[model samples]
Target: MGLSMFALSRRSDARFAPARSSAELPPSFLGSGIRVRGVLEIEGELTIQGFVAGRIAALKLIIAPGGRVEGDIVAREVVVSGNLNGRIFAPNVTVEETAHIDGRIFHNTITVARGAHFDGRMPWRPVNFFETLDQLPETQP
Candidate 1:
């Protein structure tokens, strides 16, 4: 409803690219058995139930229960119901009660449910901060 994802994609080819419509390719799901190391770029939704160590850029990212991710994440929307040990740069974020997080969160809007185990900082930022993110900052600010 704000700036178009398509327009933003054009500026971030390293992590954002055109993908088939979500209707054509269903949301990607990483199972619990999988462990990945690299960049995960998606135009649609991505549900992670595995272990990942790298960067992730997506329209929507959901860290499912039992999942664990370590690194940076840039997305329009992020919902954490698992474990995360990195930074998140997103406009909207939801941290479920089952989430176990340890890192920084930079969001325009955020909701953290009761019982969530988080050990880090949550920094509020303007929405424009997400639109212009080209690389992960060398240090958490």
Candidate 2:
């Protein structure tokens, strides 16, 4: 009877355990020597050190120094320290000093370092607007 009770308590504890956030999950990495041209989707975090020419959807994305991307990115948060010639649709964005961007950024909150080279428009959106990224208009405002 004691063993049964202990098992039940253990199960309860497991059920009530806090869920892990995207930052706490293991990150996926794309090496510097790699190149991909397709849609990339990640549930947790993704770090890129290579070249990608397609759409990327992730919970969090980091473009490391020397990385390059040419396409659209939709994420909850994004950090760029490389080169990008595409559009970004994220609620939170950070452009490091080493970043060079030539496209549009749609964000609710954004931070660009002093040395970052950016030649594009940064459109501000409400937090609720990002809740439905799939419904984004095809034309840029």
The TM-scores, one per candidate, come to 0.80, 0.81
Model 1 TM-score?
0.80
Candidate 2: tens digits of C-alpha lDDT, residues 30-118: 99999999999887888999999999988788999999999999887889999999999887899999999999999878899999999
**What is the per-residue lDDT of model 1 for residues 61-123, given as tens digits with 9 covering 90 to 100?**
999999999999888778999999999988779999999999999987889999999999999
Model 2 lowest lDDT segment of ten: 11-20
Off by over 4 Å in 2: 1-20, 137-141
Clashes of 2: 0
Scored by TM-score, the top model is 2
Q: What is the lDDT of residue 48 in candidate 2?
A: 93
